[model samples]
Target: MTLQSVLQSLLTAFNSLGRSRKLLLIVLVIILLLYSLGPRLFGYGTYKHRYQDPNTACMAQNLIDFQSRIDNLDAFHSGDFADAVASKRMAYVGNGNIAAALGSEKGLYIRLNRALSQPINFWPVVQTRIEGSKKKSTVLDVKSGLAYKMQVLSSSSGCINVGSQLYAHRSRPALLVQDIRIQNPSTLPIVVEMDQIRDSGWEHVEIADASFTINGAETVKYKIYSSTVPLLKSDKVIAIAIASVSIESTTERVEANSIKKFHLLTAVHYTQPMLAEEAPKYLPDCIQQAKGELEKGLGINEKLLRQEHTHVWGKLWYSGFSISHSKASGAINGDRINRTLYYVLSNAQAPLHNVMSTQQDKTNIEKILYFPDNCYSGHSTLKSDTLWIEPEDESQIARVVTTWMITLEKLGCKLMVGAVKLTDPVTSVLYITSDHQHMQELKHAIHVKEINEAPAHEHHVIALHKHGHHFGGLPTIFWVSIALLIVVFHLFLFKLIYNEYCQGQERYSRSRYSL
Candidate 1:
């Protein structure tokens, strides 16, 4: 059939339908058209429609992506930048009882405590000197409990790459491990020196050559030993021992276009001498124990030790909480949060059962003082007549107010008076502890009359104004309900039209039969 004839036939069929059916057909067509065009017309698929802000959506997605990965760019620092060198401070690595704040360039700061303590710089624990190389980059792999650094050596004779991985053993809190790999890419051999320097407080420092048989071949190794004097005349003694192994020779050498690996394990032990006089007697045993720990750790495969360490860290990280932001600085904020958590985790150890508390005695509480003009005091009070307002100061005040309320509640104080007047300069004050006679004493001391309570309605209005209504605009639920209602209405209309068409058909049939 021709296109015009087919269109005419369809139009005739549509016209022959009853008014109710025709109306229903038109409504269905309109609904279909609207449904097809809805998303495009209303920007339903846009990020703004879904998330309200594109920046917030981007940040949320970035956080999610970071959580799924084992490593992130935030954990890496390129040594080529000037800031990298300037910002080189120690990053913490530890297993609950013992921790080390290790610097990217140099320094190993150690701490021993059940909880986080200030790390002591035991500089020169293990120093690596690559012949003619500079540091390339540093990576902190929090998931693997490892810190990595790369160094590049370029000379007219050859080019070489050196990498080092450092970690504190999770299971063995006193043990720290470092693995060095030398990659020589040119037709020339390179030599690297490894040094374990003794700190000032340590006494009886010794270095010895040792050998270990690996894969039925004897490997040359060296040990450096040191012990600290009795801690402040106490019976305790801290001894440290380091074991170093070179896969090839006493002097670390990487053959032309080949790789060589080196291993260093440092173990620490503390002697629990019962009497101060016995500290000397315990020193030998402490040194032996530290050496024994190093030996035990060295026997284990490096890969297995790394796997176990990473597993422990994985569990800790999984148990910890995560905070995310929706601002433009969300990634930076997330990185900061992660770093804080990492440092805290590095200083935490598994809690021991039946352990005695070592906390000092609580200080006695004397009097609670309130200083209304404290914010305006100090340099500002002396220098200027005009009042200056800062957002940071306001935030600090809010925090202080919150802390004060918590403190009062903890001290069995009942809030008897709370008032805020937003006139001129704005005044806010709180009076607590009506149950104690201190309130009267305070009133007398301040020479102030009793405060008159504001009307309840006025207070209510003020509260409402301060915390403005949080109406969340139109939500998904509202739109969903509207759609459902529209569907139900269409269904009812279709049923009504069907019933009318059936009745009309019956009447027409009867009239035709009577004729």
Candidate 2:
């Protein structure tokens, strides 16, 4: 058929249809048009969103590592003591140069090695005194920082005595003395005494001092002392004295041994101010602040506070970590600063104080996935000023996951973990950054099983691919289906109209003939 004739025939058949069918045809055409142009006309699709801040990812990873290290308590002492030694060495002289006052650095290292293997007492010096004959005192010149002394007294039985004392030194900053060495130049038997003040009188405290003594005419003796002393008070000092306890009477005057030529050698320790300030770099502020809060909350005295601080620090020195980014001129290391900020936030633990309370009915995943309008105020990223959530029970993985997910979701993030058994005590699930810049990172959470057990887990995750409202436009398949339906419906209507019209014309012709 010619184009014009075909068009005319189709139009005539369409006109034969009822009003309802025509309306349906118009509706289908509109639906098809709307579906095709929906994205441009309406502007809708799944919005790209962030479930967590990529910037703080490295800090979180560091915290996880630190927590893992601390969770293993048996290794705590050695790690902490080594850090303490290194920190002290750094503070005293610095990394480049070791102070001559510390005596032989080699000897110091050896003593530190011994400290690692054995229990060592460490204390800060309060005040040091060198005493001679008849209560006469030898002086340590402040400028030179050196001490010299002579024999205090010799008994009728041939025993000589000398004294060196340590009281709290008020002028200097507080410090922890890990080990001390006193060198005796003469070869003779030497006995050292440590007298600690008690309620009644001065009492002898038995100490294991590594003594290097050789019995010869001019035998040289070396004495090593170590103490893990309590935190030194600002004003108080403990007294320590060393004297010669001879096994037998020696009438022979060995000038070097008899003169009592001994040097303080070295005071091995680090200052307290540095210790307190630098603690957060290696230890979590939450744990430390929690200890301080306990002290204040319970009205703990200095003695108790000291005990608690020592106990807590000894156990966990792991803090969050920092990763360095591209060096900006004079920019503080972003990773270090973020780690510090993480600690501060972790200790704050006041999520809903001024913030809106979260709805309880929401599932843990929903709680994480949704964000309120005001939640992102003042920050480009979702603001979770108080992101820390205390795990309800360590034994149950669900509790941990739920708690962490809720916290993360509040910050506009989601987490996925493998199928985890709640009963596995050693299994741990944590979120971490893959790199320093926190990009191209895996969206999945890590499930870590204990080294000793069989691995049991399934990959489970809530994939975060986009942000904003999830629906945008109809798919290509949907559009194709609509087109097919419209074509089929229109064809059905045209056939019906054509058949009905033909039947009517025939009936009319037949009736006229019968008349």
Candidate 3:
């Protein structure tokens, strides 16, 4: 059986085939071709058209731009999470508007007015007595037997607006005195000390006796004191105020810088320092954990970026979900499809549940999923460690589970699934490890192929398209086509073997019987 004989034999058998068998062979070839290229050429199934998840499209673009900026790459910097968080916070607080940064429609002043609980309006008149005739009485010179008097008078009260209500009062305004101190004006090294003063809530604070000696040689005695009263602006004034008092030597007065120090009570939000001892439990547990993590010089500060979330600041398994696209396969549109990514916060789980279960929720979920800038603004709720998905339909749930196993392998993350439960027909619980190694693992997972080591001009877009992706061995279409060809070739070879040997032997037996 040389090559010539084998070729002749195969040709003879093929030529001997009837027209029907040949037609069948032609039909088989046509079917194979249709199976291989039909969907790609004609557009059908998942391969009907090129798919780009609307949710991830914007994120992918921003990620490309951010990765390109070598100078401002803090967000992607390995192990520098705090700097990333700071950058995100600054971006959120655009134009120095705190309310806007906090996602409030109203301004900070409006919030402040709403936040005020106490109501009192009394503008303090400095150097004026509170008693009848509110007259100013200033002391020019003071001697051993002379008494000096300084008073701060309160003006008649009026109505003030706080939030939605107008607080009207006629009583004298209350005063909150911070400090009363004495400082030398002429000395090169300023001398300052706190003076004792008694104060009552409604009555004027008065200091009756005071004496002092400076430099151990210059003995100076002074008698007179009053509880320092805080000056309050009129109801018309929108700005809040603080009052401080300082005493200066009459002999050597420097009007410009008379007070050595001034003290006022800090605002409520800023008062209780973020220290452990004084820290309020009202702070999110994640924020507290973040503070601890920051002190340890480890992990990122998620608190600043997600102040509203309870678990905003921790490197912990906040939440996760698995989604199937079974129902979405037929629902593919320009803005949505079966295959899409969603960036959602842990706090949004309840709302997500409500939306996924109803028709109304489907429309709202689109807004949540397709966020502005694709929610990749560094403030993105997308945690690299935690995976979230949108499911297609109930039938794809098992397939989705299996697909996740492959995805997890590709991601190469050392994740421990904390919980797993079915949320609905499409959603499943999928909590995973949210440790410090997550970002590193994620970066390693995504492949940047065809990198140009030499800096190229306007090369970022091209480089990103070429480099950005996980180079999983081969495209699904190409693999499927190859599999189809193998199957078809096997069937053709089986049919050839049957005709060449089996049928030939049957004819030989019939010839022997006839002879």
Candidate 2 C-alpha lDDT tens digits along 292-392: 32222223233443344233322222454443333333333433233223222222212222112244533543565464532421111111212222211
List, residue by residue over 365-457, the lDDT tens digit for candidate 3. Answer: 768666543321111122222223332221122223233333444333233233254321212134354565554443333322232343444
lDDT of 1 by residue, 52-156 (tens): 333223223323433444344336333342245433333346665454433433344343322333222344335556764243544566665677655666644
Best by lDDT: 1
Query: How many steric clashes does model 3 contain?
Result: 13
- Give the alpha-carbon lDDT of every model: 0.51, 0.30, 0.28
Most accurate candidate by TM-score = 1
Off by over 4 Å in 3: 1-37, 40-91, 94-99, 102-473
